[model samples]
Target chain A: MMKWIMGGLISVSVIVGIITGNISEVSNAAIDSGTKAAQLSLALLGTMGLWGGLMRIAEKSGLTNVISKLFRPVAKFLFKGISPDSEAFRAISMNITANLLGLGNAATPLGIDAMKKLEKADNPGETASRNMIMLAVLNTASIQILPTTVAALRLAYGSQTPLDILPAVLLTSLCSVCVGITLVFVFDKKGGRT
Target chain B: MRFSDYIIPVFIAGILIYGLIKKVDIFDEFTVGAKENLIAAFDILPALIALMTCVGMLNASGAADMLCSAVSPFLEKIGFPAECAPLAFLRPISGSGALAVYEQIISENGPDSFAGRVASVLLGASETTFYTIAVYFGAVKAKKTRHALPCSLAADLTAFILSALFVRVFFA
Candidate 1:
């Protein structure tokens, strides 16, 4: 789905640019952006590496597991059919904890771990189950506590008070997750599951 | 503020202290964990390049601008700024694309402006919906995503609306 959209958008953009006489700029952007992606990934390396290491320490010290336990009740309520003693439950609990802290880059590895566990537990084949969809919806809605990236960008751009928008961040994320969870249940009840 | 900036560093420092109390080898574990990140980054490189290329092309072609203008009136009618429609549209599809647009908005409107703050909040609150779906499902080799894409996209829309409304109420 994303592949088709990417290809279609690129093809359409090029044709549109040619017709609009923006062909030169389009070609230049293509070249420049190819380099930009690598640079962006490299930039991500430092932050992700630092946080990844910190999270590992946290994980080994059982900090995240404790946080997981704090969220366990919520997880149990959300993940209705999953057992309390299962690894999948713990993994997903940890994943949700990482996401709530606004440690998105640090959360992916954990999120993937949970996805694989959930896949093994509830989905034996190559299709996403309703539970997996619910998890994805919640993760992607983000519900971040810190809004770190936005603050970082604001500081880089010379905002005197980068965190002033924190209130809005909290409100918006809470609303998004509520709406997303509600819709997921509606869809799940419809057996929109694969 | 600097106070907000300290939160992450402080959290990391606390973790380091805890690791010390727990008698864990911080350096070795850090390297092991960072190595995992590096390997994952390398694997994701190709996908990142392809997605970003399309983002660049779309920006250069003026197509994004056209699309924004097309939706701007409807957005304005609903109380969202016309200027922010692009940010809302691109955010769910591509993180880099949305970031580029977001930085531009902040630069143009001043970081304190309603548009700028709303864009900033939206950036922080929402995830790259399609990209996350693709990566998560791909990792588990989930060929049939069923309701995942639609539900996630719906969530993205909800986030955009809530961000715009909240920023208007709180910042404006």
Candidate 2:
């Protein structure tokens, strides 16, 4: 879906550039953006590599287990009826923690694991359960203590204070999470009719 | 050497120490995991390259400028920067797209400028809504999304509105 949209959009833009006699500018942009993407990938490489490795250590050391215990009460409300000691609960907890710390790439595996575990816990129905819906909403609007990726871009762009947007990020994400959870509860009750 | 500068290093140290306490081979494990991470980066390189190329074409084609002018009157009335219109549209669809646009905004306006600050805040606040929905739901094989899409979009909307207001109050 996304690939098609992006491809069509790009084609349209290129055609527009040709019509407007900006083909050279467009060609330059293609080259320039390729370089920027390469640079962005390099920036992501270090941070993502370091965090990925550290998270492996954290996982191996049973840190998430300890944190999972701490996450129990919160998980009860956020994902109620999900047995606290279950695999789904553990995966969900770890996923949420990864998101909170702003390790989104790290969160992906855990989230998919959690979703699979959740699908297993439920009956053999294809429809999404309440827990699945809630997890989707949570992941979609998950709070971030660090906006690492955005900050990386800011730093690459020569921002004097890369983390200066932290407070506003927090404020906006807080609003998003709150609104997201509220809507989830309101809609999930009627079997997502609203 | 601000407080935030210490966070990443501190986090890495904490994990390594904890791994040592757990009797794990920290160096070997880090190398193992980092190698896998590098492979992962390469895996996404194609998509990243394609998306960025599109971002460049769109930007250079004057489409962004056209959209900016199209909304300039309403934007001026609301005291919002017209340059952010493209960002507001692309953010939910693609993370790299918005990031590329943001880098452009800051490069032109300077990072500390009002538009740049708002772009930073807005970028941080939201997720790639369409991408997230498609990925997670696809993972679970949930054919019927059942309000999840609309609800997540509402959240994105909330983030958008708040980002503008919060940026003004905090950065201004």
Q: Best candidate, DockQ-wise?
A: 2
Q: Quality of candidate 2's docking, in CAPRI categories?
A: medium
Candidate 1 local lDDT, A17-130, one digit each (tens): 998889898999899876876765665566556666777787788877788789988988788688989998888987898887655666787888889999988864877787
TM-score, B chain, candidate 1? 0.70
How do the residues A1-194 of candidate 2 rate in per-residue lDDT, one tens digit apiece?
Answer: 66786878688788888888888899899888888778878877876677667767777788766766776787788886678879999899888887876667678888988988988886426777778878888888847777776777677778888887888889999999889889888875766332
Candidate of highest TM-score: 2
The TM-scores of all predictions, comma-separated, are: 0.79, 0.88
Q: Which stretches of candidate 1 lie over 4 Å from their true place?
A: A18-24, A35-43, A102-130, A187-194, B1-6, B31-53, B95-113, B134-147
**Window of ten residues with lowest summed lDDT in model 2 chain B:** B1-10
lDDT of 1 at B87: 80
Please list the residue runs of candidate 2 whose C-alpha ends up more than 4 Å from where it truly belongs after superposition. A189-194, B75-79
